[model samples]
Target: MQRAFLPSFLLLSALAAGLNEARAARLVAPATVQDTIVMRLPNRATLTLTVRDAAQLRQLKNYHLDSLTTRLATYITQAEAAAKAGTTNQVTMRFYPDKDQPGQNLPEEIRITAHKPGTDGEKGPTKTQVFLNKKFGIVTTKDGDGHNSFSIGTDGNATANAREDSLKREKRRRSASVELGFDIGLTTLVNSSSTASLQVPSYNNWRSTYINFGLFYVQPLHYTKKSKLAFTIGPEFSGNYIRLTGNDQWVQNGNRTFVETAPDAKQIQQATLYVGTLNLPVMLRLKLKNKEDRTTLSAGIGGFGGTRLTSNIKTEYRLAGTDYNSEDKISGTLNLTPWTYGLQGEIGFHALQLFAKYNMNELFKEGQGPKTHLLTVGLNVLGF
Candidate 1:
């Protein structure tokens, strides 16, 4: 009977022990910062977790926040000076913390200090001071502290400084891959058809075809491994020609009002002229994905304002087919000059290319019978 009672008591004790262990496992301590704080233990010494309101809890979580803040602050100042070549007057900083490391246990503590380019002690510590509190998990330090300090484990500054140095090294690698290229292509005009039965009553109609060609040089303002921005300014020359046709019209203005023995109407003759222009081009260029073997497409729009540097027109009468040399017949004062403005687009494949341009401005003078539209399609030698 005694042996049986002993076995029964031992079994009851084991059952009670198991129930208590389960209850303890279910009871979790509430975290002050987390609305739903979950503390996980990955092993004897590590933790895995997530934090959503790190910024709101920054004051309470000053140590980690300070680590991120100091790292960002150093990066901003150094990056700006590097970008502008010691020309940056001010700096801005941002902080990003590890969201997956939120638990009662922390790894290490660090403090970061910035030194001038050459000297270690001349700056006399960092320019600003940071203070932290662990109980509230916040940065409780006042602004009066010239130096800021955050406490997690102790090596926060060293870690932050290492990252800042890495970024500086990367920026140097990109600025070395920049280049500039020059290009030139021919521009030609297409002509319209003329009819003999449609002779102008007052003025002769004239038309001509011409070609212009030029070279351009561009320089890169900024260059990185992947992108480049450039500015181009250059001059161009154009050759022009003109063709003329004859026109005449007769009208009766006088009626029988004066009874002057049926007055006859008189016929009037009219003339047309074609002019040529020489232009200068100025433009800006931007290229993206500047890889060695990659195909890149770039577009540029510019205005070419030209002067009537030269002019030639040939005149012919409709009835007699008589050819008249109108080249010297019209003076610069009597003839209208040609001026134009255009926009251009280009697509590049590897080092080969295709280009197109449209002239937005009218090609003819004010009173010309028909309006002209100039379009150019060609290949770009410079694959930029």
Candidate 2:
């Protein structure tokens, strides 16, 4: 058996989970100037973990208190066994960093110490990486080539062309693969101004939702292969919803569209305008950091142009005398812009990303409907 004891702070996280959420919050001290947190257990064990950067803050945000408590308990039990078999009373445990996983993510690290300072002190350097595949961990990494690389290793000194080559290899391997994308986010009007003649109701930004679905060809930028930049083209369909804040409902008269209060306002439950479009997007993608095929941090900026496919106003209401509810879906041109183009950008870790789009065209034709453009912000997860 080995003399082992984790920093006591990490051990508290396991116990803290059992407490009420409010109490547990008190147990976690805010990160210090050094971005390190030290948590102490009631048993006098303390744990300390350092946050390297703001990106690592996402890892902390992703932690699940429930699963962590269970893991900590199990780890403590294993330490007890190790201590019983060996002569050392000290025990140590570690947590790995999360690498853009879909489900519950991993915590960066937790150190628990049971004894006073320097008690059976293991002065070994804190190791950040763990390579379970020992056979693959070659002894020497003297050259730049990947002949002695570890699993999931990335060369920070890689040239721009090397990154381009990496992109090319990815394309060659999945050239036939179709990219399926789903985007969901919030929508708002850039201009909510209304004139005396045109009464435009302000939109409820928080309630307005946007969603999109797309199937596209992942055509990499062949011309930029020698450069650090990469580009792609794709096709897709997207939908936007604008929920008016007041009782005003959309009114469409031929090519003209405006908003007016409903006759029976009390009966209305929900009023929302929906618009759909079919789109073609050309994007420039850049990877900030990579872990083999897994890009740790990536970003993209692009533009899209799409034609309006469908437009309708949906209203839900309940009957005054009865408990019955009804929905009214009135389809129309609504004087909305026939075609639209916009600039979009995204920044993300792995496949989960945050995106924003600004529509260059107005939501409706000049002098019709609300004199406003569309702006959308939300998160997306990419898949093959």
Candidate 3:
């Protein structure tokens, strides 16, 4: 890409003048030295580099700009000396590579047309320019342009291109063919069907943990090109672990299911109800990006419906002979509702994902057990 290298070149030249930019800008402490210097180029352009102090006079000492700054500094000094001596009208320097340039004989020359101090009081060059042709141009170093070693001037769009490229790379790295996610959250019931005679069990808020594990294959249905909106559908194999607090275990007597004192109620530690289901979720996602800044934010809302796969109660017991560590597993559906469905949503930026799910169906069939809706909330810590 063709660019205005001369502008940048002249800018660097002025930077190497060792002028105290900081001292020059102060109003009270006027500098003894001429800190504010200006150079008029033959192409009719003016370049300036302002700083607060001489601390960073050289600017970037190891980069291409530094090399150019040092070269311009040397050239200006020589040109001034030549103008004062009346030795010649101009000074020119041919740059040869530190290595070899196979067949090139005459290297690119930088010419500065010097002028003797006139009665009008001209102090510097009358003209200055870098040659650009088949044979004359500034040589970029082998370590130049982010180690590409072959770029000139600005690739004008380099900044924007870099950001977009990085964003694409991150998206590619985050893509998943099959997503397996785990949910770590707390569970609570709403609108409990508790009566004075048959009170529903109260759960320990902190101890009642709700966990979910799901495997899914996301299929985008309406993701248009260059669009921020997307609709996705996926089938997920899901498992739920709902823990209960207190000394009660699930008991199915005849046609109804309820919590009751177990055979070893005093020895029981924790009880959990486990449920498994196969769900189909349809999600509407809104994705956004700032191409210039290389940033992204995303959020999603979804609904899922599925039928029960399995249900069981797992109880932990503190036994006398053991170190308060004994386990019991009871396998039964316990009159849990056959159908399950819910609303779910998530919001995230970059790598963090947070989600919430609520089940609208009662935990058990009507007239069989307590009627309560399930709600789970937590962070989707791993994959999505």
Winner by TM-score: 2
lDDT of candidate 1 over 1-384, digit per residue (tens): 224333433332332222111111111222443432222222211111122334423323323332344444554356434433433322322222322365532212222223323122121112222223222221111111122322121122332344346445644432333233334444343343223422222221123333445655566666544555666655555543433222322222221000011122311133334455566666565566644625465655566666666543333223334443322233342223256767766666556666666666644443332344455555665434
| Candidate with the larger lDDT of 2 and 3 | 2
lDDT of 2 by residue, 1-384 (tens): 001223232333554433222111111222332355555556443334343344443333334534655654454445445444555433444444343343445544433222111222322111112221221110111111111111111111222224336435733642444678888999988856777767767678899999988876654432121223455677888899988866667667776778777776347678899999998988877664443545567678889998999999988777667788888888978788999999999888766789999999988888877788899999976632
Taken over the whole model, the C-alpha lDDT of each candidate is 0.37, 0.57, 0.54
Off by over 4 Å in 2: 1-177, 221-229, 264-266, 291-293
Quote the positional error of residue 11 for candidate 2 in Å.
Answer: 54
Q: Check candidate 3 and list the clashing pairs.
A: 22-52, 22-53
Q: Sort every candidate by lDDT, greatest first.
A: 2, 3, 1
RMSD of each: 20.3, 21.4, 17.0
TM-score of 2: 0.53
lDDT by residue (tens digit), candidate 3, 1-384: 013244444544444332222111111112432333344334333333332343323322323444544654576567657777876533444443222343433223444444455333434223333332232222221110112111121121232234336435634433434667676877777778775434476666676666666765554432222224555566666666666666676666767777776665357788777777788877777655564533266688989999988888788878656676777787777888999998999887766677888898888888788778888777777544
Candidate 1 steric clashes: 26
